[model samples]
Target: GEREQVDFRTSHRRKDGTSYPVEVHLQYLQGENRRVFLAIVLDLTERVATERELQEAQRTLSTLLTNLPGMVYRCQNDQNWTMEFVSPSCQNLTGFSHEQFVETRQISYGETVMLQEDRQRVWQNVQEALKNRQPFQLSYRIRTAEGAVKWVWEQGCGIFSATGEVVRIEGYVVDITQQRALEDQLRKTERLAELGTLASGMAHEIGTPMNVILGRAELLMRKAPDERTRRGLETIVTQVERITKIMNQLLSFARKRPAERQGVNLEVVMLDVLDVLQERLGKQQIEVVKTVSPQLPKVWADPDHMNQVFLNLILNACQAMSDGGTLSLALHPIDDTVELIVQDSGSGIPEEQLSKIFDPFFSTKAVGEGTGLGLTVVHGILQEHQGAIRVTSVPGQGATFIVSLPIYSEEVRHEA
Candidate 1:
């Protein structure tokens, strides 16, 4: 048989029935009067198609990484300079384009975006990583073009050369601005709440002595000798009493007393409060109107706490009508509860501030005239008593506060 030589372009079907173009190169060897053809077949179709698909996928991934809402970069070891690639998202993240950062056109990578205060620390960390050839992670703020600041977190590992030298650093930066803002706000709110609690506690502790001082001063004024001495004593006593009153208000707002859980006559309590404020009402020419239902049921609460509640509310009503208007106090029996309504013709609370009126230290009175804790104390006391309070007001018209206390029947009292 004689050896043959062949040259061919062939199509081969794969396991999937897809035909690929194959080209064969053959060589003839004729050393011992014998010939052999060495064929090298190249399958070009599948590889070309796979390369096209891979390129398409890379383009899609590139588009996604570039348009993301954060910065992505690859940097070299020297001075932490960015090299090779930077995503276009850099503009959105740091108010600078990829070009400005890469070639150090405006500033070096670390200098361009890192906050001034953070720049030194950031570079120090990078230096350490390069020295040890380890991963680096950092969180810092960046100022954007519009003068707004945003928080970013960057995490990356160093790429080492064959000799274990840090060749490059690659990382992703993410926007953590919103999370940082929320954390800041929560810290501030907690601080404010803590201060409010402290203020309330101090006011309560200071009020008791102030009340005693005012009472003693008032008794002393009655025994003073000369007219001048008597007048001076009266002034001292009056001022001390005013201070005591304000302190009491602060205490009420700050330390809400727990209900002592005693049987209370709602009608009788309201009447006593009215009696205590009678002189002031008469001097102010403010009329006191009362509507008490005789059949009102007894309530279980602390008598003194309830007294404070009625005193604060009724006094508030009287004060609102500085120009001398009618103060209406109404008591009625609602199926299982007693409703006490205090209404006045004085200037009502502003709509915008009504919701915050019960918040401690929130007041509409001139500085030194009010402590802003009256309503807050009232709210706390009512809550302790398992009661509820509500208010309605029209600016410049009037305000109404309604308090509801659970009525205790004989059966309920026995059960308790």
Candidate 2:
């Protein structure tokens, strides 16, 4: 009889009476009358231990991959850069499944994914690093499957052969969109700080003269000899006042004044804003539609600053619908904040210009028509109140500005 199949693992006693793993193979020998059976017991301890270690290592590696904040990949160096191995996180990094890249030739990692402006530069950087046998570090943008642009930071090195030829490339890539945004914000903050200093100095230098001129004009109006003279003096005072208002906004934004906190009802504030804009709304044929929830909690903010915020937003709405439209003001409470929406049915803001809307001196109005600081003032005031503002718009449909303010609490201070 020949050896039959090995039965699986089993325990076998050693010569010293110690038990160890073994696999048994049995052979049956045909004998005269009686059968002789031969059994071969192969040691399984090493194999079993090795397998256990392998499974444990696999579990550890899986956990590591799962917890990684980005995608890990191995790819070829040739054109199209065929992917040989891709981690599960690739889907989040590229909006494409890891399976899509594994052994796929349908797309090049650069031409298809990396932004057109960044593709060539990325390839050059990676290849140069590989040529020098150094790891490459790159930051670039990728167009997602949903037509979104995202920034990514990648670090990789080439795996080479004994002959100094590149065998493969391995790397980890992570989404850095939020990081880039934060960096941009920091840069903006720095710029605003510088601008604030300059504005503070200029506000003092010019403020005195502006006040003197307005005061002199008012005095002249009081002593005007005729109606025509009085009317002319009144016009001068009005223009001076307008200039003063602009300066005040500039100074306020430049100074970053701390808010004087009070419990403010957004509904009341919005109604006051609308009351001030009633004449303008009627002249422009703009209808006001307010939807404030009755149970909405009051927010902790400066009454004056909050009034300014509402005024600016309402005025913005009126300007947007110059040819008659609807202004919708909606307020609701969410979690610890009050969400207020001011939507306008007018020509919407362009996507490209939306980001700049809150920058100082950024305006959509004609020259001499606006200081371009309207929304910037609104933004500054909101920030002082420990609030946030977001805007949404379509090309021709309209624009919506959402304001989120923290609800009032004894623990929440004005400086928050």
Candidate 3:
């Protein structure tokens, strides 16, 4: 008999009654007067155990990648950053499934999520890092699937071949938008604190001279002989008063007076402020629309500061609409906070200028029309009260300002 060789894997029992993995091979041969079969058994116990260990390691790696807080990615060094592998966390980070990046290839990470303006910088940094044989870390902005922009931090290194050419890159990316915002807020707070110290010194030096000039102008106005002379003195008085007003504003900004916190009804405060501006609103032909939640809880705030806050906001709204537009005010309780919204149908702020609006001495008003510290003071007041203010605007349409303050509570009052 003559037969082809055969090989198969199985287990065999040992003399000690234990089984071990083995690979068996068989071959048949024909002798002149007899048929003979030859068999070979190869021990595979160590090999099988090694394979099981490798499988377990792969499973552990898979679990780690799946539960990672950020995205783990391996991509080629191409313009589109074509991803070869992406962890399941890709969906959590970029709002795109891993298959979209790796399998379908429908979305390229660089072309899809990364901002166009940042791509060049990211590429440059990564190349420089690779050249130096070092890891790269980058902080850049990305637009998410929901059209929201987020700040992300990535740390990775190039996977280089033996010939020193980068074949691919692997990295982990996590969202850092909140961290970036906190950093910006911190910088602004530091700047404001420094300005406050400087303002305090300048106000003291300028206040005395300003008051003297104002008093002198008033005295001279009383002694003017003719209409023209009287008019000249009047102008001096007006100019001096304006300087005094600016100095007063600087002092107010510099002051760090403790808040006289109380349970203040914002609806009542709004009414009072509106009443004060009634004549001016009428003169400008601006309409008022007010909405207040019927059972709104009082806010924990300083009454005087609240009055000032409302006054400044309403006046700003009034000033924004020179031709008389609608001023809409809304107040409601949101969770543990009370929210106030003041909207104006007027000349809105330019997108670029919105960030600078709260900066001291930055204003949109014409010369001599505004002291430029109104919004700064308002911002400071809100920060002191542990509240927040945010604004949104479209150039030709209108602007909306939202203010949120903590709701009044007996514990908060006692702590205050």
* Local distance difference test values of all predictions, in order: 0.78, 0.84, 0.90
Tens-place lDDT per residue, model 2, 345-407, is: 989999999998988878776676677777887887787677899999998999999999999
Q: Tally clashes: model 2.
A: 0
Error of 2 at 312 (Å): 1.2
**TM-score, each model?**
0.48, 0.80, 0.87
Highest-TM-score candidate: 3
* Superposition TM-score, candidate 1 onto the true structure: 0.48
RMSD of each: 12.5, 4.4, 3.0
What is the clash count of model 3? 0
> What is the C-alpha lDDT profile of model 1 across 325-398, one tens digit per residue?
98988999887888999999988999888767776678877676566767777877887777999999998889
- The best candidate by lDDT is 3
Higher-ranked by TM-score: 2 or 3: 3
Model 1 alpha-carbon miss at residue 19, Å: 34
